[model samples]
Target chain A: MQTGSLEHISDNNGPIIEVQDLVKKFGSFVANDHLNFTVSRGEIFGFLGANGAGKTTAMRILCGLSSPTSGNATIAGFNVYTQTEKIKRNIGYMSQKFSLYDDLTVWENFRFYGGIYGLKTEKIRERTEELLGRLGLQGEKNKILKEIPLGWKQKLAFSVAVIHQPKIVFLDEPTGGVDPITRRQFWEMIHETAKEGITVFVTTHYMDEAEYCDRVSIMVDGKIVALDTPLKLKETYRAASMEDVFLKLARAK
Target chain B: MLLPGSGSATLEGYDVVKDFRKIRDILGYMPGKFSLYQDLTVEENLRFFAGIFKTTPEANYDLVKEIYSQIEPFKTRRAGKLSGGMKQKLALSCALIHKPEVLILDEPTTGVDAVSRKEFWDMLDRLKRKGITILVSTPYMDEAMRCDRVALIQAGKIMDINTPEGIIKNFSSRLWSVRTNDTYELLLDLRRFKATRSAFLFGQHIHLTLVDNAGSEPEIRKFLEDCGHQSVEIEETRPTIEDCFMDLMKG
Candidate 1:
């Protein structure tokens, strides 16, 4: 079956992410070994693998949160090791257990993050209103963070991550326990963000979610064993779906 | 482990060392975090859980042989910093050290990758064939179908408990998938129709649940045309487990 190609790709003048021979270790244990991959601008790149497969390690290195033991990664024309501060400025990250103060209201959390990022109060208010409005959360500005449902908190987390409008966003399992309908809505928002020229790098355990990525890389025992579109990964492994392909590779090792 | 409304006072017919503790034996419990002492090696962690149940890994060596092989390389690593999947495997090994009759896992695959998630389930299948009672919980609907029996819970309430197929069979309507050039308009129009009970977007199509099943294809087509819908494709289909869960929630 032919899948329609994704449009509005942020001009592919150069690769947004480039990694070669990435290696990380703690004492004698190698967390990542000779990892290699590249993600183009405006693409939803999935970093997939089994638990403990070193996917997170590789992501941390690229995001400049951790230094690689060896090898190299460049993001948006900046070296992860040497230009770590610059990379942090141009990246938005939402961790698995993202914190939004329960005591704070929706707009309050937005303003807090904007202040931390040094946005002018006028810009913060303007962007905060525009973003919450876009997410249909205008009326929810005063609602306490703890009172909102899990689905809405997830959307709000994404909105907070991008309040500064970074060039790339890294979402670590952004929809882990959400319902199916809510997940679909979340992906629609992801597509909208990508359309605005932001790269999305997501890590997820849902195989069906892998199908939505522009391209995906599967890590196994600290190595990049497969990298391609979801359809191509299935074809290369002679599996019916991304799940089957994942099982076939993961079990073999 | 007090279940509200169960009316049972306390667990009976089990010994702490014999039957009560036996429940902990044979059963594997892998928490999201490997909870083993960071200062302790993997072998020490396994030995410690075994000691708690008054058994050694060697006592159940034959049963744990296969699992040992899977994690042999990381035996010396500290549990605190083990990889995500390794911690999972080690925890399972510890939980099953005493050979319990039933295993209870609370969201074992929550933080794992897609591949590890599948592998973890495969391991469960292996354990199930050994006649071990495996009771697992997950919030993912896809994982729900894999369980022999599932209890769907929300807000501390048990919504339903049954086989996956049984839950889907209990769905309360004739589900119809309707696709058109304009989904937003179709949703608005369908919601206004008396024949439609509920209409929600599922992927590229809008799933419309008929209220009374009185409308035929031509009748629905005419209704849509009158509502200004164009080139609509409609098909009747069985409900998925998710659909059934949604219905249960709505009811």
Candidate 2:
């Protein structure tokens, strides 16, 4: 619930993420090719591409999950290659497939993730109560995670991802298969989190969600074909919507 | 077999309770989750599914040829090893291999990328042309436009069923798109406005409806300016299917 207090690790004014000529190769196959981008503090950056278009590869490198073959990148002012431990400590990640334990209760899941992030016992308990209260799930805290609705599970996953108050959060298709109203509410939560000065790096299949980003970068065949604001990209491609722009770029042989 | 609930349903003119076995023979179902053997090769899985229907893949090869050919190169690979898009195609191919008259797909494009989602829908359009009654569900509102008719369901209840165009047409409220320098702040301010009935974020702009359509553009603009907001852009835009969905959900 608190905002803008976790700024001791990195300079507040510098770009939260920086990448230059990034490339990841696996046995002669290049998954990410010469990627270059910078994400400023508190900006919502949308990283988009088709499946197997190298978006995941680049995100892995930036999140310090995997080492890139060749590149210069820093996350939260720590080197991706040399300071991967520090980088991991300063960023949070949530994927659609795996973010929480299905068999555990809601409160237990929060306690477990908070423990993994090295939070104190008292702080974890306090934050858990606060989050459940905000989500209006105070009564459901004892319920198993699998029993909750899909929309509620996603919102809880997002809140848990930010429980550590990391400098940047990586969300991989956070709203997949969510209903219309819940999806918009999820974006509202994203805006609120970004307002608290946490940089959001998200990837989604929905093009309309791309319009919500401050800037979007489109990848195709392991290369960034376009990167700009949504309005500018639409105008440059002469497309009516982000969906059209994506089709034009992805299908342009 | 036990009837668990109160409602009675039928599939292809067969009562679901009395003729469940008969319905199963003519129904091709692909669940949202990939429900194939992960250790099995793609080809083996296809053959196994085909065998379940008392048929061989070769018997209905033409029906799945368009989709299967793309993943055929990886026929020997394990089903778990294929990428997201390829796994979807393989599941779809297996579902079609039974030559079922009715096909049901659940959230087939949930996590698929945009390009692959478009391609999958194109494949469905082709399948529809072949006279297969396909009943597919997707969370993406834009995809609703592709269907001849859509039933918006919320919390296990169907809200409305109509064509996408008809659904949009039924939104009788005058919707306005309002944008300003600060979108989040604008949302808060608009919600506080006296005549505003409903306000929600739609991409960069806030889609708003008036309280009984009483507020005009100038009135809303003056209210925003008075609240110390600038660079306001207001336009009366047509409601999208998503807009209608949000409206109906609220009602």
Candidate 3:
């Protein structure tokens, strides 16, 4: 397993994600308008926007799930347009609704996801044990996922997302409707994962979660209107919190 | 909807069991999930709900004027075609169309963007000023502070109930906000630090509570510096509702 400081990761200096003039249009409607940004190797990049501000469209394009109408982009040093398969192999994804199976046991879910990622059966077993041990869920490995608490299920889903040690992971509203304490725990896990050199690109409606990001980009009407550290963004907008900053930017459009 | 339960509750002096019909008439509920007929148009859904409550949309237009006016332009649009914020506004309008004396909203702001969430709460404030009693249940702890009183629930049990300020004031822990250059490393180190009682990351800093008889702030700072963390900053801070809830859950 690759476990070390971010510096130990190969290609530690260059940004893992790079996009230039990315645009995705749905017939007459422009979902992503000239989006351009770069995410560093191990940075926690928070992609925030209103419901129709084009976050999901851009994320889908980056995840190789869809094609952009016009743009240049790359993920993990592979061209998004030409090398989509390589991009898919290098990135992991977990959305709020479709990351795990409720009827599957803890071990089954891990094995299933690992298999999809092309891990060998023996390797899947080893990784499952290690992950379950780290999460203190060894006794519950055989338990069905539906019986687990929402918080633990979310954490386990995240663990399974990174089971193959992808270069980047995309989280779409991963903490929606979770209780307060569990939300913090899930973030701690995110930080731990980022510390292990996996770039985290997450989208969320929670503004406080925006503060946890190394940098945040707020999309307003399919445009990247603001991009900076939480403190810098707060100062730039002269706002007290990220929520206020978001309100000011989103309301402006 | 009846189940074997051991609880007694009332609304407007009507017992939940014996006067369910009366209680049902006077209560407006917007469940957490969007429950409006998806296949119905915006105006049709509103009219359908209004008809069920023995009212007409025109009869109570004043009550829902603020929210309904926002979506009235899209009246012919399907309920499923509206955006999240618009759907919520329509849902709130349907809930208030009957002019019920009491309104119960279940996590109305969940999954909503910050701007829409603020607008929804502002609309609630407007309703409250108009002589309506409002009860809202939300998982967002920050929303708890907006309420007059909040009940912290855990594992299907109510852990504590009080005004937001009162709950924070009663928090019996010496909380501190600790920051360092590497927050992730700082969290790992703090968890292993012998004097640490509890530590969890909150944005850029970790909300920490030291064990009783632990060393002072400077000593802890020194300890962290010795552990190779630079730019360490520690300051005494009061607990928010979330902090209080976590502490109560532990007890």
Candidate 4:
């Protein structure tokens, strides 16, 4: 019922991502249909769905990895179609599995990501040292990626993703099988990044994890059926918890 | 699929599929990926899924509206552009939005913030009151307490299934949580002790599994001190669900 359009919506600032009447089709399958939503700057948005729900397809469009069959979308004020290169430059991404080289050391991973972002060598070195020290990786800088524990690897992956300090960062499930303690530590890093005015977009299946997001969307069968804060969703569903609400919604479908 | 060789294999007290679905329905399930949309924004994502079960965001708009303010800030963000917590909320929103007869979550809190982790389980408590069958799988032993019933699962097998308290109650052995000046040295010394069966480190505390015939705590502490372990502290503690799980797996 809160159908406030993105342009007029005021909260974290202007809309960083605006999708209007978005549609995506693959042969006979409608991957996405009549999608519309807005993401404000510096907000941590949550994307959720069951498998084969077209979540990845929508992400590809926003990241400029694929074109939409219909509708309009803009990221960081640039069109996802016409200004894809610009969008790419302003946003960083980390896949669910991670986006780092196992063969490279922590410092090398930082340097590589910094280099790709076009940071100067001196700047890269300075930033790399700062990151390594902040993450308590100064001694582990030269350690092979494979040798580090999973929690440490997750931390390192986050460090590399933000090496260039992009305006927005997209993460797909960033935490899957890691221990609970490590996952908590990783989220601390995410909070730090968001504090710096960097928008975060992430997709995951953990309902409890959604309570931490600024807002969340539930996707089923290639469409988004609900979008709200965890508390709001709970209250609306008349369910005591997000999980129950999820089950209720999932079964209703 | 891997059943214990020692058990009498029978289903429904009869056929596997005949009773599996019926029994499974008494439990809820939330897979690592509940299978949602990736490309759609938070709003569309909810709507699409809502439509699938013959429901609309409009039908449940009031309930959705209650959580709306929390997600309003990021409502327009694409599903792909959200964070772990955000995605978790979305996925849960999809799962609970329809209200199932049973709720099942597979490692739902595996990767999330401490605050979010707490918040998520709190939601589950509310749902439990509604009398929905809840079956959840998690690797975290601490979360065991939150469930009405827990089934410690490993490698697709159920190690133990019982109420949280019941599981802990069944932890047959007495546990000692000890810390020493030379923890590693103490561990080595403890391992060789005739009364000790297992000695391993869990964070800062060294947990020792004692033999059935082990001596009293005071005597054990004295023995440890005599072995050159300084400032030894020992507590007779109840076994955790994890301990039971390990015991089950060992069997």
Candidate 5:
């Protein structure tokens, strides 16, 4: 329970993400066990845990992509279970795996994803053009996604994930295998997105990236063992960096 | 021990190209990126690896037993079908199938999850306890701390090699962490500052170096204030491996 809030809780308008005693199970095996926390609007909340620490399970439940065995959660003011479709419309999803269709051209991928989000034809075209220009992919707009470099493709996947301008976004290890340089740039993009008033919930194994978060929750097994701002966690653990803070918590019990 | 497109290298006091078989006999290598045959089961892969070292699996069963036991439950399952962690254990078992004294792992935990990544390192520690020389490389700087010593590399060039503590201690710069309402703009402002030596993005703060100016802190504070940054705070900070790596890369 060594902790500080992601932000000083002064607004009291309710968290954009609220999970209360959340639980998920595969028969007798518990994936997420009575997890409780809230993510503020436009905040970069880093969800961290070991591979099987229930980070993914909780995120899946939050994204309305899956159901929990019990407990309650709400995202963007919508219930995760009863208001999934409504929740889905408020948040974008991106993962390490490029979500763009490899066989489709860059424009096609953007157009298709933009269409799914109910963007008007004119809006989709405008966003696609803007996205292409922003990514410096104007020359590669017609090229199939498979033809682009992995770095560029990852950026496109992220852009398309947020193409419809959701109120919040969930990034599951978005730059998992990217090099240091590209990873930094990707985070800058995240900052830009947050600047635009979109909350970002990111789960990552890279500790350096975890430092970029406003606050981080490090889960162990099926429970959240440590939660705080990266600097605070480091101080609490008497560690120099987030990686050590993570290692300290991960090895604590 | 091997570098691409180079002349024959020496390993364990033997020429890699000239003493191929001799070198192979005493070296244990787990490639950075690897795949086990989808059609081969656990035992089958071990048998194949044993053959590569010109030995029977039974001869070195004891050496691989510890790691193999973890994956033994899925012995009949295809190697390709194992979970990432299990697959890594299996790969390690295969590499150790011949009881080579020297173990070389290239990013063995690259894609493994956090828990399994720790487990893998624990296993390496056990191997080290048994007098094995373990050589490992990982992109994660944090993992570098677990080692007895480390070398910093950037763009195929070696920056420095020292114990993790040594590298941090040797970072010769006045590093500071600057936090403000807008970190992105803070970085841009610092980067544009004349006295700024190097500026790196570190979580919520910018890790910066000053160009030996007496009023550097106040000057930086003034610059951020001019940029209209709110709640700005700047303080000297200890450098992490990532910070040092960024600094080293600039050189």
Candidate 6:
């Protein structure tokens, strides 16, 4: 009966992400409604929600890409309103597209993103070699992005995003269309990065990924309805899986 | 639709190479990608497909009424501008427009959202109840449990063909639920264990496949505890469809 993580984490300490009643409105439509949550340092936080459930809006606010209509949020100790540039420098992002230049070779793409992040030439080369070796792509330096397998490209995208050694990395549904093998490989990379003390804030449709998170928050119609570890959330909802819990919460409203 | 092989294949009791024409009549094939006329409106695309089948949309109105009602509001909108879920509904509606006895959907939920994917499967269940023989192919192992019977195919070879539960029944290897606070370290530690065959995160727990039978639990559990993980709990767990598929793939 001694379940370590089966209990909800209400202690709320070491907050890397702090949101206070965050609200976003486009015209009269509220995309985010008084959202509140916290992500601890070095935690893989899973942001779960149905389509158009304001997950993107809240993420935009955290990334300092968009201004909230009301309330507030802080990322890496920088205020979302005023310290956006500082916040941007400290955070990494990998979208669904992976955002790599298909025409460029692996090294060329890495060099381009490295220069954009203001990394020195020597630092870029060092990180490039280290990353390629770590990903088992050391021999693929000269290959074009499009020619490489999708799983490899995704890994490269993730490496490029964190090339500047950001404090936090935001991944928005990175493993959506991949098979189970690739997904496991991708999650291994996530675990490796999280081990290095970089915070991973990810949003995913797959319930299996939700289980990988240190903690998760489910958004429903622009609000944080459930925020707990996967085990605790499943226990609270009396559901077998996160998908079932999502359906139960998503349908209850 | 055509898989090349050394020998001939069969389709619905007919030889695929010999009865291609006859097989096409009963098959309502929907390509994974939405392959409708992008410039055409929703109604226009449906009408076009209906025409190809030598029937008017009005003649098959009852057949597609259930699905069409969901996407009818966007009847005038171009197919290219529709959302992912709407596109899926439209594609399904068009596929039903032919009134074929068999429906073959090739991973219809590939790039769709979770809610839409669930809805798509629900639609399939309804169609199945109408006495349609549905053959759905998905790359998602988690969906294997949803079907009455599944064929595990890899590289043009059939691994196993049986009910979902039957496939799991054949997973002779013991699987474990290894839970710890630090997954990264836990993975690294588990990988170093002698008896550990495979360790991967599933949901919140690391699903470990032991190399031998029931002999490695205590040793692996002790190893985890020795790594300074206080709440490490390793328990014998049942294999899921994905676990069975993974075990099958290893051979």
Best by lDDT: 2
RMSD each, Å: 4.8, 3.4, 2.7, 15.0, 4.4, 3.5
DockQ for each model? 0.31, 0.54, 0.55, 0.05, 0.29, 0.35
In angstroms, the error of model 4 at B140 is 6.3
| Predicted candidate 5 versus true structure: per-residue lDDT over A49-114, tens digit per residue | 876678878988998989988888989899998999999988899987646899999989988999
Q: Which stretches of candidate 2 lie over 4 Å from their true place?
A: A1-12, B1-3
Q: Which is superior by TM-score, 5 or 6?
A: 6
Candidate 6 lDDT, tens digit per residue, A1-253? Answer: 1124423222244577889988899999899999888787777888988777888778888998999898879898899999999999999999876569999999999999999889999999999999889999999999988899777888899999889989899999888767677788888888778767788999988887787887789988898899988889899999998888888887676
Q: Give the per-residue lDDT of model 1 (tens digit) for B1-251.
A: 22345443222345434354444444466564447677888899889988988889899776666776688788888888676667777888888888876777877877776666766788889888887788787767777888888887766789999999999888868888887755545766888988887776554467788777668777778899998877779999888787787777666
On TM-score, the candidate that comes out on top is 3
Model 2 chain A lDDT-worst window of ten: A1-10
- Give a tens-digit lDDT track for model 1, residues A1-253: 0023545455558888889898999899899999888888888898888777887788788888999998889988899889998898888998778868889999899999998888998999999898898889899999999999888899999999989998899998998877776776777777678767889999987887777677888888899898988767888999877888888887787
How are the candidates ranked when ordered by DockQ, highest leading?
3, 2, 6, 1, 5, 4
Instruction: Name the regions of candidate 3 deviating beyond 4 angstroms.
Output: A1-13, B2-4
Ranking by lDDT: 2, 3, 6, 5, 1, 4
Candidate 3 lDDT for residue A16 = 94
Q: How many residue pairs clash (N, CA or C atoms closer than 3 angstroms) in each of the candidate models, in the order given?
A: 7, 0, 0, 79, 1, 1
Of candidate 5 chain A, the 10-residue stretch with the lowest lDDT total is A1-10
**Residue A157 alpha-carbon offset, candidate 5, angstroms:** 2.3
My TM-score estimates for the predictions, one after another, are: 0.80, 0.94, 0.95, 0.54, 0.80, 0.88
TM-score between candidate 5 and the true structure: 0.80
lDDT of 4 by residue, A50-159 (tens): 65577889998998888899899998888977888988888888876665788998878888889998999899889889878878789998888988877788778878
True contacts kept of 1: 0.43
Model 4 TM-score on chain A: 0.92
Comparing 4 and 6 on lDDT, the stronger one = 6
**Candidate with the larger DockQ of 3 and 6:** 3
Give the CA lDDT, 0 to 100, for residue A82 in model 2: 94
Better of 3 and 6 by lDDT: 3
